[model samples]
Target chain A: MIVSNMSKDELMKDIMAHDFKLYDLQLYLNTHPSDENALCMYQNLVNDTDELKDEYEEKYGPLTACSAAGDCEWKWIKNPWPWDKGGN
Target chain B: MWEYEKKLQYPINIKKPDPQMAKFIISQYGGPDGELAASLRYLSQKFSMPTEITKATLNDIGTEELAHLEMVGTLVSQLTKGVSPEEIKAAGLGDYYTDHGISVYPQSAAGNPFTAAYIQVKGDPRTDLYEDMAAEQKARSTYEYLIDLADDPDVIDVLKYLRQREVVHFQRFGEALRTVEEKLADKKFYMNNMINQPNKDCGCNKPKTKDCGCNKQ
Candidate 1:
């Protein structure tokens, strides 16, 4: 789902979607811990999140954290910052 | 769906290099405590972060460090390009040359490898975030020192940009830490101690030794 074929914009959209959904579920579950519909929705969102995460990682380096596989020369330690793109 | 902020994501243009300043400037690339370490330090800690705010801040700051790392790299790369092997050796880049043979890596301007000791993965939000905050200040101070040594206008411009970023990051982390504190406020254990205790069962008791269970006062 997160393959390089997807544009950076699309991948970013998917990431934001998952983040918001994760937060929504967290907030809902905090009060309605037994809502089966919410739980199921949360599970589905989580699975989507994972798949997208994998895709994004394979294509545009990593967005969240490090990879232990050693593909990156500095694998465990590195990233492109918000302003890492250089200049203003 | 999340709307992306395009303004926050763009490439930086480090101006052209000056050979005379290149040698000394490259030192920040791999000196004992340099930008490379700072980037690696924050980026590495995100793996074990406990809170979303902490994770997000780490992600943002870590990303910024990578940019700074590039600025350092770009500075070194541009500086060393035109100089011949003889020139490099004479310029004291001989040590730098022996390690990478002119390849600009993030290891060090001196060519020493990166180490994990530069950062801590304490696994507690409070401790890790506080370390991150301190790290930003230290990095900003380092940038200030670099600015003091630098004579090139382009180099100074880049350094100033980086220094301002450190301040921004410090502020964001402060906000994140407050969020964490707010979450912990309801818990009696958190209310009693300013820092979170490492031993969850230790009940926020202040430790007697240097390795206190809590990270902050």
Candidate 2:
């Protein structure tokens, strides 16, 4: 999970950037079939992104207005807002 | 994975509804070439995409389109608020409400509902990406027309937002095309006119004929 706090806009911008990068990587891999470097890079990005997401949730209120206490009847309502990095 | 705050995603403050414009705009909500189709079309095709980059692009673009769809739904909902059966009938919305019951649906404003034909799932990346490019252009033109037809500021604002996304999607699709081309071997890229050749359906082994069995153009 991300430990540092990033501004909402800054974090969203990062999310968009990463989204584009990941999408590009995914498309490239489809035709190229295999590229270990791309895979590794993709993996690293994914891992780092999870940390960023955690940081975002902790700093802001739940991305969604719902509770995230994990013992809820409907967990989906706990989903973070789209602007939240988690949406990315 | 991306991190963002929810409050910022929809920053534009939309005022109360204008019923007149709402009627026409709802067509886009359910229209053949409207936001619902765009969202479902792109989102459905993402799974069949061959590359990670393409899939990711599809996901992002598809997701964005979904947001656009929601915006259209929101507009429709707001427009219909406090509407009585008589007012709805007066606005020619009774039929719409009868079927959809004030619920947002994926049908065309003409009353034609959502069809799988809206999306193409060709296994061939080239064909699918090109279709995506065309779809963006079609949506862009529709927005332009909608803007031309409507004069309300709120409607215009929303239309403008949707229009900008079309341009962005077009750019992304172009990039996606180049990305696909760059992956091709030099010999395969130039020697064979593979792009023109009939693209086989990636979803199923059956060779794709003239049409990709998607929605009519």
Candidate 3:
């Protein structure tokens, strides 16, 4: 679980780092499909990314359209964009 | 079929506006061998790819090109953000300014607007992969030229990063081409239209055969 007091920028940086790792791994796995070690590492990253995304959405609102939920009003449009200071 | 990520793949924090630099950088945004062409080429080519690995490789790399396109756009925007009208005209951006008024438009350094004619979506996987490999090198060269023209460390750093990506993409495309060649029939190695030929019944595998597959109608 992420620290509750982390700034939006800090949290987003962490999430983006994880997402980059996932994308890199995905490209590698596409070529080396039979590599068992890479497959296991890929699985672990997937699980970690899911957790990070969930934590991010809970604190900073949904990163994607599908993740928007809960009793709060529509939050997808509420947050600042990634280029904006708070959004990053 | 694709989702947008709001942030740049790499950060761009240019502190000064230099319209001259923006002019050269715009080439990568919409030039003949630019990121937009790269993305469209791979994405359009993936549909007819013969193997699953090649198809997925094209898709992944194509998607990354889209992100790169955004990065280049951001660089252009930042570099031209606060230039005065006189500065813009002095920088030889007067023609671009007259059209778009400091907005980022997909055009080469020479002011040619991006066109689909710049890319090919050949159904032949090997041919298309070879084209992709060449496109990466072209882009890398363009980046090198831009880096040479740019004095700003911030801009140079990003340009170097992008150039390195082109090298990596070229390597991957080369691997994909090899993968494709390994899958082709031994005798049909250099035959044109190997993937699209309807009747592959020619017994070219037998060295003593008088009528090779090539002689067939």
Candidate 4:
């Protein structure tokens, strides 16, 4: 996870924040499909979230099973599982 | 159809292990109003939903409930991790340890096994949405009760997060319900909506009103 100047915890905080924002916006859009500003924000946030995930995967390995390249090692089967201490 | 994201929706790094607290916390994993029930309830109810909004809301919220389930499972696992048998007996988990050991089995804090009968899957759209809303509120209340019993700041913090999500989900379900009701009253339900479709061909789940001659067709 040492792909950038930010520590793993700090980077994870950013990623979680982004994911939460996207999820909240998605719920809002479900009820208010015609909202103009929310629509625009949703599109931009999707791209931003994707970029963050790519950065995370590149550094710490894949964030998902689909993203696993397995070039060197099987990253999907790696440690933490998002539950253990220091997990994600 | 869902992908496993290798990180939590929110981070949980509980340092202290409290088996006594874990015993009660397991309720959220398998109790009547547990995350497992909530996820299965919403996901099952989405299929017969009349509107796109309700379906998406149910589907997404159900998926989020799965994350909550994982969080609760983690809480239970970490809280009981490496505890001695003597500690388990003292914490009143002796029966559970004898049955399931350290594994995160889906059972109530009271030791009742998880059952599908805990949730309802009425195909009626409005009925299903209302059930989803009630489920969220009940989950929120359960979290509050857990908070009252928990002294660990680490455990309380994660419980607070889960409780807050329940409140948010209730609001969303309410909104979705309002949208669906408005559409139903407007008499412009989805063309794909099974009940009283535009062509009057699909009439499943329709009430026996004069307007709904589903049986006549």
The candidate maximizing DockQ is 4
Q: What is the TM-score of chain A alone in each candidate?
A: 0.75, 0.63, 0.83, 0.89
* Tens digits of per-residue lDDT for model 1, B1-217: 1232222222334455454456555545665456676667667777886676667666656665664665677666655655688887776677767766766655543445656666677778888778878877877887787788778776787678668777877777787788788888866642644356555665446446867656576
lDDT of 1 by residue, A34-85 (tens): 7899999999999888787777667655554444345536532344444333
lDDT of 2 at B72: 77
| Residue B14 lDDT (model 1) | 41
Taking all chains together, each candidate's TM-score versus the true structure is 0.54, 0.62, 0.83, 0.87
Which residue pairs clash in candidate 3?
A: none
iRMSD, per candidate, in listed order: 10.0, 7.8, 2.5, 0.9
Model 1: what is its DockQ?
0.08
What is the interface RMSD, in angstroms, for predicted model 3? 2.5
lDDT of 4 by residue, B1-217 (tens): 8988888888787788889899999999999999999999998888888888889999999999999999999999889888999999999999999998887989888999999999999999888888888888999999999999999888899899999999999999999989878877785544645544555755555456876555585
Per-residue lDDT value at B194 in model 2 = 49
Compose the digit string of candidate 2's lDDT tens values, residues B59-152.
7777666656767776666666666777777777788767766666666656777776776778788888898899889888888888987776
Scored against the true structure, residue B151 in model 3 reaches a CA lDDT of: 99
Candidate 3 deviant stretches above 4 angstroms: A4-6, A68-71, A78-80, A83-88, B185-217
lDDT of 1 at A54: 77
Per-prediction backbone clash count: 10, 30, 0, 0
- Candidate 2: misplaced stretches above 4 Å? A1-61, A65-67, A70-88, B1-8, B188-217
